[model samples]
Target: MACRQPPLNSKRPRTLLCHDMKGGYLEDRFIQGTNTEDCYIFYHWASIDIFNYFSHHMVTIPPVCWTNAAHKHGVAVLGTFITEWESGKDICESFLSSEDSFRAVADKMVQIAEFYRFDGWLINIENLLCPDAVKNTPIFLRYLTDKMHSSVPGSLVIWYDSVLEDGKLKWQNELNNQNRVFFNACDGMFTNYNWKEEHLQRMVAIAEDRLVDVYVGVDVFARSEVVGGKFETNLSLQMIRKYGFSAALFAPGWVFECLPTNEFHQNQNKFWNLLCDYLPTHSVSMLPFTTSFCQGFGKRLFFRGKEVHAGNWFNLNAQEMQPLFVDQKLAGAGGSWVRTRGCSEDAWNGGCCLLIEGALVSEKPNVSVRLLSLLAQASPRLFISFIYKQDCSDRVRLALEVTTTNSCSCENSQITTPQDHRKGTIPHLLPETDNLVSQFKKQCDTQPVEGWTINCYLLELQESFLENVFVNISRLPDADAKYKEKEEPFAFRVGEIRILDVNSLFAAPVQVQNLTMCNTLWRRGFNDCKKRENQLYLSTTLRWFYPPNTAVNFRIFCKGMEHHQSVTIAESEKMVLIGRAYNRVYRVVDIPIPDPPVGTSGQVEFLVQPITKEGFVGQSSNCSRLVVNYLEKQ
Candidate 1:
């Protein structure tokens, strides 16, 4: 559970999305599961700096899926430790009863976060506190904050704006003297959602230099005096930015819960698009930058351009680094424009691909889409490669637009200077014009997979680092074309992208070892048939070991086989995506007995595949596997 990922260290005005839907937990609680139905998965990790998995439960730990997805995008994820109502009063009395007990509870929270590999917690107490509990509240918050910081380097413990210091359950709606004590006890505070313009101004004054720490609350459901929630949540976001305060958007999942299911994807993008302009931007600084623009859910699953599983599936852990796509509405005046989003209908890799589709009219011949934001150091010799399928006749150009500066020292040499210099490659001697350098690559003859073209470009930097990458799509000039009459159609799907140091060689991760299953829970269920024959389902936690720092992601796959089979054959077995893991531990749920028969057992083989931070997956032969007995109902 030791976190290998870096922590959030930005000082900009940030956005923290608190996800709350219905009650506490649901299908996502299973972590990894066989269910392939549509689920509420947050894809706007680039816009938000932090994510809080909120619910009414007393100790609401975020599912590993949320943590994995958020961390993959360089976003921090937090769990909720909340107590509310009459039952919460009893719980508070027991935890806040004595100094030792409150400290012990705080320690337990730290342990939970360490084991789950999440960032931190959001402490919410909504019930009236007794005199003794009120006296111990600040003590508890201070202890939790100090412990979390020490235990998990950049972790946070934010106090919600409720329960006044006088032991009254009063909502101040702003950071005032009543709750300033609690704010002083933790990293920051989440103001009540009913806050007004004056409240924001007052909180800014109270927060002083830590202004960004005070996350002004915005309830997306439009509940109780909440300004511009739901579709117009941007109003609150804009106002918060105007006052120089961070934002905590509660229940942004309103798009999934209240909107039409069929239009969830588009509507979700639209909703986030409205607020994206008001939120702060985040950049990827790590080297070997890569992404498929996958939102981590799809109608089916594909690996290296071939179909792996054909079923509707969603697992946030499978999400890759998302792109900051330009809003279609703001792209143009309708003459020509391109809109990009993850398309699950088809993909060259993973479950989704970046779909760039638009029209080119007489007025507009080419469209440039800003794809990714990078702060990585450009190597002396750099190699950039990507996979895409051009479904239209229009020509597409992908380029890296870099703005580099000469550092005081040769720090870039440590990050990416080429050690191996061979023939046919040259140093990037091209002079920078207007402080910007653009590197472009043409479609090569290499086709590692069918239906996709690979484009690779090499650049050698003297002392500069990368800043941004952009993709341009243009219509090739045709003498017979009649662009003045009609608008031409253009579409492309980018399945994979990688920027690597030419000198850096890829080392496949060591095979996973010590694979084990524990805490197994089984359930008796009936199939979809009318016969009502009994079936067995399984839920268990899987653990394995791999050499440290070998990979950033682990993909868990399972296949069913006859118990009598001793040798594992590839073509005869179907590999299903059970889920993904950020670390060695993963919990799988509701794995139905494939073709379960009365009193018959089979063998299940689980495979662990390690994937590098730059999307390079290890060879199947180098991966590890475990076979477990599947017992059917007698």
Candidate 2:
């Protein structure tokens, strides 16, 4: 195929971007924010259960064959190369022993650039521990730039500075920034997430005035892939740049949880800096504990004291994270069902409140409310988990509906025209949602109120993820418009929230039994290394399929209770016991959490099948039984 020629009138400079891992860019738009009309996601970090040790040290980045398919689109295609762990030792170690590895990688990058003909390079200097850590990195960067510049002179190099975060006046950010200046290197940089506005100003000021040919890059964890003609992340980039700062996408890792396999039209695509792509995004912080929005999935509803401020799905920056050596095991629960934040001084628990809502509120008059917009790109089941206190004066209503282009000329689909079933039950197959529309509408008439107890609610809808109401009236002036198009805040008291993709449950093994007991004991005697040793029972409530009368073999995967993703089971032995001997089946394995799995995740999945050679009796019915069990949750 012939490579397309660049337009002569185009003034945007060409650039080279190298991140640590591979972020296959897809051109799909799922979310829309301010200037994100031309924005797309790159990659965000992987799930604790999904991303672990083996993927950390090195990676092989694949070319973006999908991005090249778009012949008419004017957007530029960029690739990345990243560094694992912000540890300088890791970076040096990778390049130290094998010079050939670096050369081979560099050669591959050149080949990719020549082949794909991307817009420019998103050069990242990821995860710098301090100035001392990255001092030698500039040497490598300068040499790499020299080689790269020799060929791709028009290529831009964007660096991610880690030193200037909210706290810790570390030497790394300055060292890297100054080194880029000393070498007359770097086209621009993706500014840190937590740095102050003033810090951002100074960085941009220095890049434009001090550095010969540099700019400031703002990294956005946009809520969606497309806003206008591009991904939604661009809106944030545009907003930040107007303040004299440029920007780029902080890529979300592998899967697009918001999108289902059917909606495979790649709408959420863009490039982001990776850890191995450069350094981890956290390690690349330029400020200290600046406490900004951390990337998340599903949808987010923000609360300040007793009011809801803003709510939207969070777009993750996968490329900016380091792979965990020991990852958490996946709990077979669907999208986040709960949320809460705690005071920095809260004594109840540390980050425990991170999963609850309402705990983060202050004792002030109620103000605004925020509601989340569900994704249409994929099937979504919103589960909200938060702790509500008595006499809180705020009524939390959870509802979901279908969303579609609703202009008068637009055709009606399941999302746009939902069937009106019972007033509150789940809307069967339509693109809408069934919400836990708070029955406790009025502020409780009693302390330790009836509705204030801790509870988990399952809300499924064929509709949408948004509604227009403050408290519970469906008429808040400030609610987001995905449902009604109003733009006002709602009142809410919150802690943290957990949003799970209902389907994600399929890949996770079944939780055998309650670990609350094991968890408590482990915390005490387990040497702080709370790895447990038990083949805890899987609650067996929900599952895709269950085997019957089988002697087939499989093992149980175990882990700590508090730590869902970290497996404590020895890979060698994993067979779990279930049922009695006669009707007792021993060969049930791969007990996946049901699609839209319900109930709080609690054990082990066994590979069960019949000892019969007669093609396994009742295979089909067995599957049906499994589905029935899953749907009949408490």
Candidate 3:
């Protein structure tokens, strides 16, 4: 129902995302920090869970996770109100029989939208309608839109290009007079896939003023009709833009479904980057980021260490990045539960810990928890905290390993090399036996000291590397004989794996200074350079110094003085990590000149914030603040 709030006004051509595959569950992969500028609306396909026109059971509400994630990106989300086959035909006949029947259906649809917090509905009437029902279809749609708009100001009602005004189940792949009647009744129209270039041009002409309303459909994996299916999806986008029309990318989950599991992240990026090639980046400012992991709090399935909630699947959203599992499986035939004394207390946020009672032993040497996504581009000084309970006979050992490259091989030697630099990779290497036990003793207070001990391991990598970090637990080889008699399995519970930024622990903040401006034509003897004087092209460079081992990547943000709280303009690419204890100069090009306040000099001030390789900024700066003041040239 209509639980979603209104989205911000967008200047880019609308990019409508149609969620249809695997029953709208696969869109989870897109939540991770991906660019979403062109995505104006997200449509969760088909509301045929049940087949009553007036019952909420028949309404297919958009998943709450999709609504939350889409709205966070300022994109509107819609649920499908669909009718198909004989049941759909019967429902439509009842829905369109009279004015009261039409109002009843419209009010129910609005109520569903309100309950679910979604923006609107996608009316897909794919069944053939009788002559009387066909004649009143527009009236029903118009009434629905009017009621929806009056109740939810920024709500939408998209007309799927399925049924025409004449009540025929014909797919008009373009906007013509046949479908223009319905388009005029709703917010916009989703063109059916298989449209020609001329069709796009014709639709664009018809949508002269509201050209963004026309979303040309491009099915990324619809083998029969989609052109340039995989990495070449840009071809369809190029044509849509050529005619100044919006684009609807159907089933982007093809990247995940078709590619090998190990190559999912790489292939997903390659596919979406093709879309970025055609769509411009929207200038929206994002807040500082933080992520933490906890199991048993809110999780659905556990594959090893990765835990995903059943109904909630949007893991890409920054806020929902926790409760990850690596390789969880059902407790098998050999697995047996045992009574454990205490649970490991959660280290990040105080919560109940996850208990491991069954025989966790397997043919595999270790079970690992991945931490790279949280540690990517982060400071080298990191802390991992978890709670576990182990007796003197317990043989389980916890090891922390980091792999620098994206190779799926878990071999320690292969991880050190800079072979494939993509994001997904396998866990590699275990801590040395001596180091593992010693570190555990140093970090944790075991049984005699306390029933369940909290362990916090502090790690400092020597160099900044794009790497995947994993925490693994393995059984020691020598302890099997001790359990031979009664076959009692060793049990332990693990709390959350908290990734702490150790750089923030240091009391001293870095210092920044020496800001200077330069024009494109500036040279040693170019002071007298003569081009169009009014058309000045300027860039700025600044120097900053961090304490030993505290180097971090930084970005410059600018905003107009009058709109101090408005969206900040990111003016520079991330500066590479500075060398320890050294002064580094960063140059930003094509910086937009901000308007000065009414009575002040023509000067603009910008803030420089340090960011991790993973694009995380701390809520508060432990580092010194750097606000550069630039004066306008007279």
lDDT leader: 1
State each candidate's clash count. 1, 167, 26
TM-score winner, 1 or 3: 1
lDDT of 1 by residue, 499-526 (tens): 7775444332356778888998978687
Per-model lDDT: 0.73, 0.29, 0.50
lDDT of 3 by residue, 21-112 (tens): 55543334342222221121221111001110111224677655466544533456778888888898999899888889888989998988
Query: Can you give the TM-score per candidate against the true fold?
Result: 0.82, 0.30, 0.45
lDDT of 2: 0.29
In model 1, the Cα lDDT at residue 558 comes to 79
Model 2 stretches with alpha carbons more than 4 Å out: 1-60, 70-76, 86-88, 94-108, 111-136, 163-183, 209-235, 252-634
